[model samples]
Every structure is written in structure tokens, then in C-alpha cells.
Target chain A: MNFQGIFSMSRKDLTTLVIFSIVVLALPIWLQPFGAAYPDLMQKFAIFGILAIGFNILFGLTGYLSFGHAAFLGVGSYTAVWTFKLFSMNPIPALIFAVILSGLFALLIGYVSLRRSGIYFSILTLAFAQMSYNLAYSVLTPITNGETGLQLEAGDPRVLDSMFVAEEAGLPVSNFFGIEMSGIPGFYFCAIFLILGFFITQRIFASPFGMMLRGIKSNQTRMNYTGFNTRPYTLTAFVISGMYAGLAGGLMAVTDPLAGAERMQWTASGEIVLMTILGGVGTLVGPVIGAWLIKYFENIFSSFNESVLHNLFGFLPDGVEGFVVELTSMFVGEGWHLTLGLVFVLVVTFLPGGMMEGYRRITTLFTGGGGDGDKKAKADDTQTQPAE
Target chain B: MDAIFLQFLNGLDKGGAYALIALGLTLVFGTLGVVNFAHGALFMLGAFCAVTLRKILTMQKVVLDEENLTAWGTPTEIRTTYVETWFGDFGTQLVNYSVPLAILLAIPVMLVVGVVMERGLIKHFYRRPHAEQILVTFGLAIVLQEIIKHYFGANPIPQPMPSNLAGAADIGVMMGMDPNIIVYPWWRLVYFAFSVIVIGAVFAFLQFTTFGMVVRAGMADRETVGLIGIDIDKRFTAMFGLAAVVAGVAGVMYTPLLPPDYHLGMDFLVLTFVVVVVGGMGSLPGAVLAGFMLGILQSFASMTEIKAIIPGIDQIIIYLVAVIILLVRPRGLLGRKGVMES
Candidate 1:
């Protein structure tokens, strides 16, 4: 199929895609004021954006909450790193291998886990992920290299690369042809993939399969009674999301060719869930925005210390300034997680649909429910409205 | 033979802890129909209750003595706990028994915490999807643990068991076996015995009391019981408090075995969920049964014989068993019909 045939975007969707691409590509310029322009943090934004967008496919659409998505990510990273070690330092083959291996892993897990729904499915996924993490840290030490993590050794042969060219002096870095996947170039590489991932997610969201997943989420029994077998639909969504996670993991390895078991930890999985919820569950732009917000907080907000807080509160009187700084410091720097927790709770409690709902509410409040406001409201509604 | 016996004892001790935590989890699930991811945080809070009491009991005043300063050519500082300064040996003994005394503090504190959490947060989420409930509670758990970290720092705070019960007891001799074959910590036995009593008391309170009857009825059918004019919501709030206390005391007693840390709750959270699932959701006896069974199985998996065959069985045994059980028997071991099966 041609690109247009695959996506078949409407005018509004095309506008949304164009706007989203511009915002993502211009992140370096836009985020400069916020002190997040550096490539490392920007790469994280793109990478986690991909993760959250993929997660939204299964979670937001199908409402099948998999608490073990991180396992696929870890698998991807391991596969990518192994690809670098055994075959080549080239990123193309590494990412392909990463996505394929993690998809196979997800297929095995999703087949068993999708049999149950709700919290049972959550538990099953959590179990499989934990098992993977445990084995990675112990029994799979030869493959994973245990707690010290898998890193490229200086003398290790890149079999495929060595076949083509003379081996480099030091440990070889991952590259696309000769272009090193690091710094600004690396961020662009990840950003391009993020845009591609977003495009795919957008197409999926607007497709009939997306409608079927939503139908299953609304009422699986009704969908079944309507002569639809929802299992393959859910499983396909699961594998697709898993592949997305794998792609993100592959990107992580491409930028920094080290893979740790920590990426597969349950808490890491929780963080993914938190990002999707913090954005807006079913909305297209929500997860990307959520991932960016969280990555910003994690990188920029966490860098604030007592001295920075003091400077910010320097205008106040001595006693008051000290108290204010102390209070604010607890929510930033080492305590940024506390802020994350607070924000997440507030989002879930007040804005169940997340930041997208908040935006929709603000638009309606200002526009008085007419003209552009009506169209925007209707679009948001179609995305998130509970099925009748 | 001795190794197996010791492993069995270790399993029971571990199982006791598992059962205590799972009992409260299943209790809240049965009563409130809320999936409280913060229940583990309550357990962590209960453990911190002991840490707090110890900190308060050992609050010291420093006195500078000018005459005792030859080494540094400055006044020597002498520190004495306020309790020691006032109550002498009795204060010292109180500090030693801080872990047990924490139960008293945990009961009331956890009760208040549980009630507030249910009324303030979980009550609002009852009508929401189980996913939302899990998300909110998970957020609360992070907040609670972070607050604890802010106050106590991230390191594990060791709570001393009573001085007399500090040493390991030779169980082999008592059981008519060779001496020195099976040595077990005295405190672990105490923990096991205490968990049994607590579990029994919770069961009896529900089985016998009128209040318990109402709560049980509410669990069976909240709307029907509400129609009968019994304030089921209030009782559920109370049951949430009761579950908190059970979890709290379990945490308090567990301090000696594993030092209290901000991350303690999170570590136990996944394992307890597995235990609860294996036992069957909302089944008290099933949770307790599954808790002990998995704990024992985990202990056995950690054995050299088992590890030789399975390698990392000890690390993933509970989750492995949970996956198998959940796939084979979707309702869990003792699950009731039509509860979360859909």
C-alpha cells in the first residue's frame, strides 16, 4: 500500500500531524527557555514519547492495562545491544532485531495474558515482567551480564562490521552508516522515529481496528455478542504496543549502547502507566505531551537544589524566604518524584481524561460553546467519550 | 533432614508475614471493593511507627563537661536520652522494646490513616473503574513513601528486638533432634505466633460481632444492605481502618526481620498482590492460605537442591506460581463466584 493509502488522513488529521511534527522538530528551540534544549534530555522526550504513544494503543484504546510493558523494552534494549556486539554497530539492523525479538516476546506473553481482563490481566503481565527481570538479574547472567549491565568491551569483535572494514581502536559506537548516534544527531534520529511512531499511532487511532478496540473496551461481552472475536484485536494491539516499546528501547541502546535490567523493573513499568494517565488516556496528542512533561520534570525540575530555590525565593524576607525555599525544595531536586506523585494524583482525581480534558475544558470555558469551540469539543468527545 | 526442617520453619515465618499483609488486602477488597495499591504503604507506615517511637524514646540531650576535655582541648560532650535521664533503667528497657510498643502506636495511627484515606480518596474512587482506583492508590503510595523518605531518609532503619530474644534458639533439641542442627531466631517464632493470633482475631471479629456481620453483608451485597438501613459505607470505612491496623502491626513486627525503609512497602506490594491473587480475590481464608503456601514454596525454592535445578527459582518463584495459578484457575484457590471474573 502507498503511504496515503495506509494513513488516509483527513484534512484535520493532516493539520494535526503537521502541527505535531513542527512542535516536535522545533523542541530544541522551544524548550531552550526551559533549560531542556540539551540533546540527552530531548532524546528522552522523543524516546519516552514513543513509549507512551504505543502504550496508549493498548491501554487507552482497548483498556487492557498491561503492567509488564517494560519487559519488552528491556528485551529490545538487550537485543539491540547484542546486535551491536555480534553483528554490527549499525543501528538499522539493531532496531529491526530489537523490535522483532520484543514483538515475539510480547506475542508469547500477550497470548496467555489476554485470556483474562481487568486486574487479572494486570497481574499476569506484572508476573511475566517480574519473571523476566528476575531472570535477567540472575539466571540469564550470561546473556544479560547480571547487575553490572551489558556494555561493549574494547576487544569485542563486531563480526559483520569487521567483515566490511578494519576494526576501530576503542569500543565502537552505534551509527547509521558513518553518522554517530549521539548528541544533536542522536536526538534528531530519535525525533524522526518519534514522528514516525506518532504518525503510525495517529493512523491506528483513526482506523477501524481502533474502533473495534474501543468497542471491546466499552463492553467485551457486547462485542462478542455482535459476532466479533475481540481476542485477536486485543492481542494485535498488545504486540503493536510492545513493538513500539521495543523501538523506544532500541533507540535508548542506539544512543547509549548499554542495557541494564533496571529498565525492565516494575517501577519503570509504573512510570509508563503514569505518563499515559498524566497526558490523557484516549487522546492522540495526550501521551506525547504527558511524556514530554514528565521527562521535563525528571530532568530539569530535579536539577533544582536548595541554592536554586533560595535564589528563586530571594525576594522574600529572610525568615519567610528560608521557609519558602525549604517548602519548594521538597517538591524539586531530589524530591521531584514527590511532585510527580502529587501531579499524577491531582490529574487522576480531577481530570480523569488527563491534560487533554483540561485543555478541552479551558477551550469550552473561554469560547462559550460555539464556533471553533464546538468543533474542538466534538473532536475531543469522539476521542474520549464513554460508549453508549 | 535438619536443613529441610529449618527451611520449613523459615517458610512458616515468611508465610506468617505474607498472610498478615494479604489478610488486610483481601479484607479491604472484600469490604470496600476498592483495589488499594497503597495498602503496602500502610504496612511501611506501620514499620515506621516503630522507627518513630524508637527515635522519640531515644531522644538525647547533650551535656558538655569542661573537666573531661583533655583529648580535644575542649569540653567533652556526654549524651543521655531524656527517658534514661528521667526513668533510669526503665527508659532503657522501653527503648529496647520499641518494636513491640510500635503496635500500640501503629494501631491508632494506622486506623486514622486508613479511615482518612478511604474517606478522602478511595471513597471518591469506589464508583470509578478498578483501573482508576489502582492508579489513584498507586499515586498515593508513591506520595506516602516519598514523605517518609523526606523525614527518615532512604536508608533502612534497624529496630532492635528485645535484648533477651535477640539470640537464635536451638529448635533441634526441643524437637528431639541433634543439638545445633536447627537454630532459628526467637523473634521470628514470636512474629509467627503473633501473626496467627492477629489473623485469628480478625477472622473471629468478622465471624462473631454484629458490626462484622453488617460489614460481611455489605461485602456480599452493598446495595441490598443499604436498602436494609445499615450504614454500609461507614462500616466499610471502619473496615478499611481495621485492615490498615492489621497491616500496620504486621509491619511493626517485621521490622526486626527486615529493617524498615521507605521502599519496604513497594517491595512487598507486588508480592502481596501475587499472594492475594493466588488465594483468590476477596477471600480471607484463601488469601491467608495462599500467602503461607507461596511463602513456603518460595522458601523451598531458595533451597540449594531446588536452586541447583531451577537456578533463580527463589527470585521469581512467587510470580511464576502466580502466573500458573492465574492461567489454570482464573478465580484463584478460594475465590467466590462472579467476583471480578468478568
Candidate 2:
């Protein structure tokens, strides 16, 4: 209940937190050897992780399933790009502007959408996202640059103290405080921001506000009866989460300087929701893990071709081998979506607590598994018990 | 006045599509309490049925036509095949004049698919959270679309209308206006008529039939119906299939108006959902009415005058209407008490 209470947590909690932090810190190093290009995948994971974290604050804590979070991400990306075009090429100012812009957009959207809950809310968010996507694709062409996307123009005057000419080939021109910010340096910058985001989220989760949000999630009626204005709390969480999404979007553009209307699409919003759910809703680290897993699959699966399949299936006999390869190929490469869908179905239906629960179960298994099973059974029994 | 009439006609065609798709969505939602994200995919499958039927109808066998040597100076074996090899001779003959025939074919196939989907995938998800239901259905939709795309490439395949109905009808001349003023496509008119028939049939079936009575009872309260010893799940599955058939039939007829593509269902999916919500979540008649109103409003929003006043109004019109409806009547125009809450 107190800040110091969380900070001075039990040894078990402290150890778990420390272990998670170490794993996150070392994840890039562990992932570096699939090729020198693997860090790019890691950077993508971090960016999506940031977005998913923001999304969880609303979805996991408030039980509001938004199907339009991508609009905030798009808004953030666009604002960041615009900031770079008009004010400064520095990432900080662009990120700040993006967060502020996204927060404002989220405030407006959340207010209207939150009026109805459940499927209605989902549909509302989806409609708004679709509208945003359509406008970006056509009506807001001047701002969004239509379908071509927002890109760096060499002719734009930079008001920043630092001078760095736009790069013509390979990557965008970037000089961060007179040091080049291309390739690995750019990725590290994103990584630093992601770490900062995690820290902020960690603080939020351990705060009284987080407790209030959990209360709202559990019973809005009770909170209302207790004389608390539930709307402001929900609205605040929505805006904060929106700002986080904006920050992620800004980072995305900073790492790879382009903002496309597709970023605001309903599908994009769905992807984040999938990430949050896949990672383990209501858990601080679940979304990040889910984001990494999905991004890993996206990048790695797309790169798989016939040769890769053949090599992987080399041990099998000639006739059956070809069939096996064909079947596997159907669910890989271009067929990776099938696998993703199946994973989602399986997780939601069978493992509703998500990957984090699996991890928790494993940990429990190692430390006196017998008592854990009884506890779980009791929990399930309680869940099925009659409500008062 | 002519421009207005033509726009009205266009609105009717578009409204026909919204009504059909929204009707299907509402039926499934009403009976099963599932949001069915894959409804669009089912629509896409229905359109693909036309493409499949056409392919089957066109299969041929080669035959020698030596008598044609009078023109070429040499005898040649002209390749000809029996269309029946693909769809049976009856199907081939019907294909020539067969937009209606395609509708008939699409119905059974789409119905089977709908029933199978409901039984195999959706049945398991009835008690799951809305999010899970959405995710699974969304996955199913993606899988269905990808399978279609894999079988038929990513391009839109245009299906020809029946030859007699191919040309545009000169309605302006009949109305004592300039001949070129307002011409409506015959196929589109036919589609509108077909939609009306289907809509009428569905309403009639629900209103008059004993089976419809049972289904209506189930939709009103599944538990009550179940307690009375009716197999609600089976009936729900039937309703799901019926919804699929409606959507598929709409898609099949819509081929001449818009080419069938893998992504066509997705394009209509969001708009149709909005219509269903606006109509009041489980009300069928409300869905049909909202579909037409939104359709006309959308078309009107696309007008030059409206565009001049506010940009992108056409795209956002339905959503704006939905927001307004929610604000004014959160349960939608005809939503029953306690329906939209869950």
C-alpha cells in the first residue's frame, strides 16, 4: 500500500524482479548471433513492447478492450515526424511532442468510447481507428502524405543547434549531439528509451493509482458506490497509456524515419492487443515477452523459404519428406499467420493466464509443486462458487 | 433530378449489400451472443463460390471440326470440352444465364460452411470472453482469406452478368428526360430485386415458420428455450448457417456490381458491423433499416457538395452516425432491453 512497502518487498519478490531485469538487459546480447542483423529484431521487440505495455494499462487494468490503440501510435509517429521536419531532428523533442499529441488524441477518443463498455466499446474504438486510417489514406493527405507515407525531406530547415545532413542511402541521416545515430547506435537509443519506459511502468504498477485501477477493473460499481468518480481514473489511465503508445510510435520513426497510414490501421491495433494478451494480461513483463515472441516470429518466419524447409526436413525419407515439408511450409513462411492464430486460440482457451502463468506454474513446480496444485484447485473452486 | 435518382439507385445497391451482411451478423449475434469477426471472411468465401462455379462451368473437351477447313485449307481438331465435366452440363447451361443459379449454388455451400464453422470452431467459444471469441474468429477469418488467396491469386476476378442483362437500362428516356441523363445497370437492378426477395423470405421465414418460432424463442432466451427441451445449440448452428447463406448469396449477386476479391469481405466487414450496432445490437429489422439509411447517407456524403463542405465525410459518416446514436440512444434504435450490455 505504501511506496516503501513495494520498494522494500519480500526477498522472493526482490529476487524475481532482479532476475527479470537481468534477463531483459542480457536479451540483446543473447539474441545477437543469428547474424549481425539480429539487433534490428531486438529493437523491433522493444518498440512493440513499449506499445503493448501502454495497451495493457488500459486493457489489463480497466477491462476495456480497445481495438483502436494504433491510432495513438500513428498520431505519435506523425507528430514525431512533424517535429523533426519543423523544429529539431533531435529525438527528445520529437518524442515529447508525439507523447503530448497522442495523449490529447487519446483523451478525446477515450471519452467518447468509454461511454459504452464491452463489445460496443470495442466496435467504437475499431470504427474510430478505421476512420483515422481512411482519413490518413485520403482526406488528410497533406498531413499524412497520403499513401506514400511521411518521410524526411532534405529541403526542410532544421532549427536545432546540431547540423547533420540527411543521409541519401541505406538509413536516415541522424546526428545525435554531433555523434552519428545510424544502425546499432539508433537501436541502443531505442533500447534506452524502452528501459526508461519499463522503469516508469514499474513505478506505476507499484503506486496507489495502480491499485485504484485494479479496483476499477474488479468492480466499477463498488468504486462508484464508494463515492469515487471512476471516469476520471479510467480517463487518466487511458491518456497515460495513449502517451506510452505515442512514445513507442515516436521511437519507431526515430529508429526508422517513416510514418505510414497503415500504422494507424485496425489490424495494427489488433496486433498490440494480441501482444498484451499473449504476454499475459495484468502482468508488468508479460506484454514485453509477448511482443518479443510475436516480432521474432514475424521477422524469422518471413525469411524462411524452400531451402530452409528442405534443410530442416532433410532427415525424413523421400516421399513422406516432401509431404511433411509441404505441410510445414503451409504453416510457416506465408503461412505463419495460421500458427499465430492457433497460438492465440490455444492460449486464450487453455492458458488464459498466458505465458506468464506458464512461467509461474513452472516456478511453482520447482518449489513444492504439491501445495501449488491444491491452491490452484481451490482457486478454481472459488471461481465457480455462487456469487452473493 | 436525374443525378439524384442515379445517386439513389447507387445507394440502393450499396444498401442491399449492407443489409445482407448486417442481417447475417445480427442473426449470429442475436442467437449465439458471439461477435463473429469472421463474418466478412464468409462473405468473401461466398463471392469466391461464383469464381469456382464459373471455373467448373467452363471446363471443356476437345473435338475435331474438320468442316471448318473451308476457311483454313487444312483440317484441324478444334479443342472443345463438355462444361459438365466441371459443373455438370446443367450447371454449364445455367451459367450462361445464371446469376440466379449461382445464388442457388452459393446458398447450400455457404450454409454448410457456416454450420461447420459454428459447430467445429464457434461452439467451443460460446462461453469464452468476447475478446477470445473475437480473436478466434479473427484467426479463422485470416485463415479462410489466406486459403482463398492461395487457391485464387490476390487479384479481383470479374464475373460477367447474364448477357440479356449486360447493358444499362435507359430509365431517363422512360421518365421523359434526356436519353443519356440517367441509365441504371440492369444487373444492379436485378441485384436490388434479388436482395428484396431474400430479405422478404428471411423475414417471412422468421415470422411464419415453426422453426423460425423456435429460433426466435431461442434468441430471446436460450436458457428458457433449452429448459423447454429444445436443442438450442443445434438451432443456433442452423441460424449461423442461415446467416452465412444470406451473406454468401449477397456476395454472389454483388459480383457483377463489384468484382470478387479475397479482401472484399474485409472492406465491407467494418462498415457492416457499424450498421448492426447502429440498428440496435440484436434486432434484425433494425439492422435492415439502419443498413439502408446509412447506405444512403454514405452516398450522399460522397456528393460533391458535401465533400466541398467537409472532407472525408463519406468515409466517416457511418461512424459519426453510430456515435450520435450511441449518445442519444445507447441501446440503438430498436435494441431490446438487456441485449447490448454483454
Candidate 3:
């Protein structure tokens, strides 16, 4: 329970962190030849990664599987859009407003929803999210702009002197501290925010507050009986996580400059849940990997066509060439969703700890690690020593 | 008053769907304790069954007549022959004359599908957490919808009602009103009647049959029932199939009300869940009652006056009611003691 000791990074931990940083930094360069605008996609990946990480704090750590987290995302997006519409096109103000608004919305939803746990909690959140989606889709069209989504307009007065001007007819207006909010700049801006989010999360992970959250997750009744009000700790974690989602949502709006009701849909919420579970629920790197994986598949697999398959199998038999193309095409493009679903099932069934755990197992196998074994032995030694 | 009566009937028709869907959901939830999110998709599949069957039954084969000669000296006659060879003319005639026949066909097909799904996927998730169960079923539902969409295309397919029951029925005249003022569709009336029979049959089966008794016992306590040597898993699987059949029949009957489409399942999923929750998690009677009550409430909420007071009340009334019910009585109307105790 020594805070400083826990917070102090070991040499191996520092080395791993540095390696991860280097990998993240070089990801865009590595992905450039793949026809993906690496920085933009990385930005998106990081944003969703942040969202999933926050979600994991509540779900993976606390065992509260909320089905309404996208509502917070939607709230953030809407808030950012509105800030642009009413106040300024400056990304700073817009994002700040988004985070605040989304946080408030999450606080309200979480307070009510947290009243019930387990299945009831899931149903409560699902109902609320659905209600939010429906209202946003139809009745609140004046605000959400209905199915067409809210977009940046030319007529909107740029009240802030530092706001970015639209470069072209269909360009996004973004002016954050005089830095042009065009393509690369925007991506870098989001990346910086993602790093900030990651840092905050890392700090929390090593903090006593984080320990309290883990304690609450492990045994809430015991924590309460041991003279601690657990509500404040849980609420704090929920709010922090909500803010992360809001920040992600704000970045989404900033990048695309549109806020649609579909963003708030239950499916959207479910996707984040999928990302969290797929990546490694409790691990920092897992959600990021999961988000990147899903997004990569969504963007890449969807674009696959007959020609792509033909190119891959040009060496096949002439008569069977068409069949190969047809078969491959079935598992690619629109059919890629089937593959994604299959992966989800397989992961949940076989790798419940997710891709991070897989990575850990590989590492442990290579290193001949006995970290877990040592901990178990130490516990046994302590028990024997006390008996003696 | 006439409008009210018409709305009431509309409510009943809609309530029939709610009852059927909720009944299915409750059956799965009660026996298996798996919140089958895919139930709506199954219902949608059932409606598609009618559409698929209708297409199959009406398929025409082109035959070339070699004996005939045209004016242009071409010995050709391309006559399209209706494939009435398989089923007699009467059977073909029945396909054209009644939509009710589709319901009969859909039930068995849906039952098989339900059984297959239970055996293939849901049976494994009985011991998993609710979240995983929800996610897996949700994934299955999405897979089902995507498959349906892939095969049927994205657009809603309009399945025509039988010729005899295509137009509005003059139910108003029977109730001492102008026939033109409050005309209900004959197919909808038939649907209502069919739902009644289905509900009655389900209730009767549960009330009077030995299998139903055992299933109920299994639902009340699977452990105790299993300890006594009843195959609870088989019974639960059968119950899942029964639930699927109910939902399928509902969808088949509802084809006239709304066209069948892949996304129709998702459109009704949340609302149906609301009905299930409002009815109580594992309470059958509660589900049926809540379905009817919520259905009527929704219809009433869609009234112009109600809309004027609160826009979008129709869409959200059920959820609001669910929240209120959950807040007031966490166990729902007829919820058992420890169903959601975790």
C-alpha cells in the first residue's frame, strides 16, 4: 500500500513503455504504403482507444457492463458541434465544452443506472441509450439534424479570432491556438490528446484511487464494511471514464465535423464493448489494439473487391478461377462482418483475457517467466513463517 | 368515440404482436435464463419465411410448344406454366386465398430454426454472464440479419395478404357504427384471432400438459428438477423452440401490418425488451400483461393530443413505463423472488 513504491517505474516497465511509445510513434510511417492516411486513422484509433480504455475502467475493472457508453460519445460529439455552431470554431473551446457536457450527461446516467447492478443495470443502460438514440433520430431533429446529421455551415459566425478558416468548399473549420486544423495538424492534435489521456489513465492506474477502485471491483461489501464510502470512488471512476469518451467524441466531431444520431445507437455502444473485450479488458494496450483491429478491418475489408481477389489468385486454374474469386469475395467486402463476428465468438470463448493475455503468454513463454509462480510461493512462505 | 374505438382495435392488433414477442422472450428467459436478443430476428425471419414461401409457391416455368407454328413460320409457343404440379390446384388456390396458411408453414420452420439455434449456440451460454450471453446473442442476431439482408437485399419485401383478406373488414357495422367510419383490415383481424388462439394454446399447454408442468418445474428450479432426473437442458431447448415458434407466428401474421425486412428485428428489439422487463424478467403472465398494457399505452401515446403535449411520446412511453416500474417494483409485476438477485 506504499503509494510511492507502486508509482515508481521499474527498469523493465520503463523499457516496455518506451518501446510502446516508439511503436505508436512509427505506426503512421509503417502504415503509409497501405493507402491508409496513417495519421488520420491513427488519430481515430487513438480516440476510440481512449474511449475503450475508459470503458474498461468501469466495465473490466468494476464489473459493470454498461450498454449506453455511446450515449456519452454522442453527447460529446453534439456538444462539440454546438460549440462550433454557437460560440466558436476553435477546437480547444469545442473540445473543452464537449468533455464537460458529456461528463455531466454521464454523471446523470451513471447515477441513475448504477442503482441497479448486473442484468438490470445492462437493461437500464440499454433502454436509456435506445431512448436517447430514438429521441435524437426523430423528435430532437432540430438539434441533432435527424438522420442527415449536424454539419459545419459557412454561415456560422466565427466569434473567435483564433479559429481556423475553411480551406475549401467541403473542408472542416478548425482553429486550435492558431495551428491550422487541416489533415496532419488535426491528426497530431488528436494524437497529443490521446497521449494526454493515456498519461492520465496511467497515473490513475498507479494511484491509491485506482487501488480503491480495484478493491471495490474485487469486493465492494468488504470495502464498505472496512469503513470506506465506495460511492465517491466509483462515481469518480465513472466520471473520469465518461470524460475520456467525451474527449473521444469531440475528436471524432473535430476530425469529421459532423455529429449523427447513429453515433449514439446501442450498436455503437456495443462496438466499444467489443473493442474493450477484444483488446484486453484490464490492460492498457489491449483496447488500443482492439480498436485498431476493428477499425482496420472495417475500413480495409470493406473495400476489398473482385479485382483484389483476382490479383491474389491469378496463378489458379482457369476453370476454377471464377469460383476462387467468388469464394474469397464472400469472406471479404460486406461478408467481412461474418468474419468479425466469428472472431468475436472465438475470442470470447477461447481467449477471455483477450489479445493482451495472448501477448503476455507469448512473452512469458519466451522469457521462461515465473512472476505469478514467485508471487504464489511468497504467499505460501508468508503463511509458513507466521505458523512457525 | 369512433376514433377511440378504432385506436383501441389498433392497440389490440399491435398488442397481439407485443404479446407474441414478449411471450417468446419470456419463454427463453424463464426456462433458459438467456435473454435471447435474437428473438426479434427470429420473428423477422419468420415473416421472411412467408415471403420466401410465397415466392416459391408462385414460381412459373416456361415451356416451349413444338407443335404450334406462328404466322412468321416459326414453330414456337413460349407458354409460362404455373408450377401447380407439385401441390394440387386446390393447394395452389389456398396459397392465393389465405395468408393464414403461411402462419402454419412458418411455425414449423421457425421451430426447427429455434431448436437449431438453441442447440448450436445458446445452449453453451447458459452458465456465462449476462453480458456475454447478451453479446453472443446480439452477435447472432446481427449475423442473422446480415444473412437475411445478403439473401433478400436491404429493402422491405411486401408480402401480399390473401385475396379474400386483402382489404378492410367491416367490423364497425357489427358494432352499430357506420361501416365506412371504422374499418379494420381483415388480415389484421385474422392476425388478432390467430394470436388469441396461439396464446390460448400456449397457456393451455402450460396449464394442462405434463411436458408443460415439467418445463415449469424446471424453470422454477433447474437444479432441483435436474436432481430429480429430468433433462432440464432438453426442456429448456424445447422451450426456446416454442418461443421461436411464437415469435415466428407473430411475424408471419404481422406481415400484413408491416412488410418484412431484415432490420425489422432491430427496430422492435429494444421495445420488446422493454416489454419483457416491464412484465418482469422471468414472469410469463407478467410479460403477456405488460405487452398488452404497453401496446395500448403506446397507441394512446401516439394520439395527436398526447403528441402535442410531448413529442415522441409514442416511441418512448414503453421505456419510461419500464423505468418507472423497475423503480417502483424491482421485481416487476409478477417477478419471482430471486430471478435477478445477482
Tell me, by TM-score, which candidate is best: 1
Lowest lDDT sum, 10 consecutive residues, model 3 chain A, at A379-388
Pick the winner on lDDT between candidates 1 and 2: 1
Error (Å) of candidate 1 at residue A231 is: 0.7
Q: Is 1 or 3 the stronger prediction by DockQ?
A: 1
Computed on alpha carbons, the lDDT of every model, listed in order, comes to: 0.91, 0.83, 0.81
Per-candidate TM equals 0.97, 0.92, 0.91
Q: Report the C-alpha lDDT of model 1 over B120-238, residue by residue, as the tens digit.
A: 88877777788988898999999999999988998999888999999999999998988899999999999999999999999899999999998888888899999999888899889
Candidate 1: count of backbone clashes, pairs at least 3 residues apart or interchain: 0
The per-residue C-alpha lDDT of model 2 at residue A173 equals 57
Task: Report clash pairs, candidate 3.
Answer: A164-A175
List model 3 lDDT by residue over A293-335, tens digit each.
8988888888888898898899999769989997767667887
Please, what are the lDDT tens digits per residue for candidate 1 over residues A1-388?
6976976789899999999999999999999898889999999999999999999999999999889999999999999999999899999999999999999999999999999999999989999999999999999999999999999987677899999979878888888899999999999999999999988988888889999999999999999999999999999999999999999999999999999999999889999999999899989989999999999888878889998888888999999999999888788887888899988887887778888988987887787767675667665543422211
Candidate 1 ranges beyond 4 A from true positions: A2-4, A370-388
Off-target runs (Cα >4 Å) in candidate 3 are A1-17, A33-37, A162-172, A363-388, B63-81, B84-94, B97-99
What DockQ does every candidate get? 0.56, 0.41, 0.33
Q: Candidate 1's C-alpha lDDT?
A: 0.91
RMSD of 3: 5.5
Q: In candidate 3, how many Å is residue B258 off? A: 1.7
